[model samples]
Target: MSENSINSARRAALGKFGLGLATIAATGTGNLASAETTPTSPHPVVLDRFDHIVLTVADVERTCEFYVRAIGVKVETFGSGRKALVFGRQKFNLHQLGREIVPHAHRPTPGSVDLCIIASTTVDDVIKHLKAVNVVITEGPVQRTGAMGPIRSVYFRDPDENLIEISNYL
Candidate 1:
């Protein structure tokens, strides 16, 4: 395909994901990776798994409470009441909206993240647990493509309405 048509097609695809060309232009990340190609021209960097991710929420304690009940994570208080939801190999630092720590996102908005998490338990068991805790499953026990391969996922919303997909690799 011609470059112009390729770019136009990419823009259309991104638009379907609610990502506008403006978002791409603003970030200057237009020429990112695609499933069809690997952009390995740059030097490959060796890296371990993610240490943690910061979750911006309205109320830290409330978000912590919901994650604890919904996902079985242990909530821990860190420096100066900073909260984190700790799972086996993942930790999410809870940044209470306006009171975010330094060097955070440009606009750390709550409910902006569609986070996909790998669960240790079966998706069916997770659905039952979610129902038991009064958490509404938005969608799934459906199949989806994950980073590693096929995953069975159940979707739900956090306290801040962040879409959470709990999945098990199949």
Candidate 2:
């Protein structure tokens, strides 16, 4: 057979397979033949927003304290005394050094992550708060592109050396 015919056959098979998988996911049944019964415009699974993020830290207590004081989040304990920093509806869960849970980041080293946190207040106010807490600003009051759009941000670090950007949407 020619290469073009082989490619066309492969594409047809893959398209059928994808539709079958989508059906199985929607109905929680593993019947590939049932795909035809599913709606033509099946709703795709979409995530709304983040609820929490885990930060692997060298010292959980120290990291928690830094966020509480500098970023103005409150600490909460849950599920066998795990510490989390809570702000609005989101949180940062702490995983202590040498005690990381299974299925974590490939390189769960301290200071490895660079996270940009959204600030409700202006960047200037964020700067003032940082100075008041004696947290050193590494850079910015600079413009950067955020996930939602344009933002103004300032950069700093936590006790674990994780680069943090506090940003306000512009």
Candidate 3:
């Protein structure tokens, strides 16, 4: 089919949901009813980017060390000797298994996350670093869709089998 014909068909299909293709592209996919149901006044609760995250681990020390070696995160100690793996503005607070600090995830489990982190350097450099640290890459330095758009990524498993993806925006 002609490109114009295909595009028209796609637009018509999207129109069935009461939204045109342009609206969907600009506003993102959300409940269509939200436009009518949402309050006109600003909501009280507002949130932004993550400040830190928690990783419940079998061995906090081991996890910290592995992250330090593989990704160049700084291992830090805070109040009460609690450990955190820090990079850029975010940190991963380590919670030892069966002894997690209070106010944790309802079902916090190790190796449950498939986290994608943006790297400061190139994907090639990240691959080289992972190899030097003896971390086996499970997937790629190939093209993948990142949150912002196209990215090049490398995948590997951390000590607890958590899938770690290092990416560079393309």
Candidate 4:
């Protein structure tokens, strides 16, 4: 399709959901307006949850092993030998340093992310498991507010220095 036609279609789609075309165009996808101004549509698009997250790591094998041993996720290969860490219903794509796919994060640097993972077990048990895996705890087991409610969390750094928070709802 022509660029003009594509832009028009995008505008029309956004208009149906009460979003101004100018706002969308000005913000791009990365820096959208805050949630407070988000309009409710009569037939709103419902989103479930994240399917996968991609992380650029200095060493794919080392990062995969760390996640498997520390978080109990299993490693799987897909699409030309690319590696991923799979657990529950989600997976993390591993992109090797200097080998990231096109159209990736603006600055897809390793060791630059902080993420939280929910745990089914108690925070105390999580701590025990971490110790058993030789992973050091950086902080917490303290109460924090999560999307659902109060959570007990412990913080630690992954092998690539990404701050990881393991939390269980209280």
Candidate 5:
């Protein structure tokens, strides 16, 4: 077959295989190795295998929408009877804002509620995504020690002004 025919056949094969143009081109050029089936990580170290993280929000539906629409997290369940909103990797419980729990005087203080979510993505990406969604970030993607080890973290608040931390290891 002519070179054009060979190239066209390869292109069709790659398209059917769901490979990107870059991956197809690299394979065609023979510069990429077969061993490199997937992209390589710089560290390649395994992070924590956490099952879930939970947060308390004032409005479960609003909080659930924020996560699903903005943060790209899929909602697993909406509360039936005071249960939390369970998303892809996290769960959030909606604590009703009332006169007893959230007294008129206690509405202005810090430490009322706080939560942090750790992800595989970088700290910068998390900050950018949150900022895009108008989520006010208060702290850094700074490195810190946790139960697992060191991690990169940023702090922010939900609609209820509850402190939240989003983190991943550097």
Candidate 6:
């Protein structure tokens, strides 16, 4: 898509969901898409250590398995019956109700946001480990420029279409 088209779409989306975007940003819950890089509203900020990240999945069980066995997270369902998985100190909760979520059908929008997984071990070790487990690796064990400058990392995907980036910032 052209730059103008992208900008127009983002502006339209932001206008439509301005309140929701504000809520997410205020809570430090997730990333929000915006146009023109406008300054966000100055709400009282209550920053806390991130506890979990949530994603909607079509099949909760399938997502559970991929995260538990493939990506190596501890999977569990709460007494309230909510399913969640944790990997590398990050927790991800999967909800089946997302099908009713607005813009739901347009799910898995690639390039929306990249989820970075920090590792203390070498990136190569992670690549080898995933390969040994027969996990499909879509990309990289190469150096890429990051916010902190260049770093080595590997990229892959989970069953629910989340981009997973593993990097050792050494």
Please provide, for model 2 over 21-41, each residue's C-alpha lDDT reduced to its tens digit, 9 standing for 90 to 100.
Answer: 445444545566666544443
- What are the Cα lDDT values of the candidates? 0.76, 0.78, 0.76, 0.75, 0.55, 0.62
Instruction: Quickly count the clashes in candidate 3.
Output: 0
Tell how far residue 81 is off in model 4, in angstroms.
0.3
Best of the two (4, 6) by TM-score = 4
Model 1 per-residue lDDT tens digits across residues 52-167: 99999999889988988998899988898788999865699999889889999999999999989877689999999999999999999899865544679999999899999999
Q: How far in Å is the alpha carbon of 29 misplaced in model 4?
A: 28
Residue 98, candidate 1: alpha-carbon lDDT: 90
Model 6 per-residue lDDT tens digits across residues 1-170: 86456655664554424533344434444443432244444444423235776677678888787766655789877747878887544587666743433444355432344687666667888888889888888888877644333458898887656788877544
Clash counts for the predictions, in order: 0, 0, 0, 0, 0, 0
Off by over 4 Å in 2: 1-43
TM-score of 5: 0.52
lDDT winner between candidates 3 and 5: 3
Q: Which pairs of residues collide in candidate 1? A: none
| Collision pairs in model 3 | none
Off by over 4 Å in 1: 1-44
List of clashing residue pairs for candidate 2: none
All candidates: CA RMSD (Å): 9.8, 11.3, 8.2, 12.6, 16.0, 9.5
* TM-scores, each model vs. reference: 0.74, 0.73, 0.74, 0.74, 0.52, 0.60
- In the range 1-170, model 4's lDDT, one tens digit per residue, is 86456655655554433243233223433223331254445665633346799899999999988988888899999999999999766789988889998878999989998888777778899899999989999998888755444569999998889999999766
- lDDT (Cα, 0-100) at 43 in candidate 2: 57
Candidate 6 local Cα displacement, residue 77, angstroms: 1.8
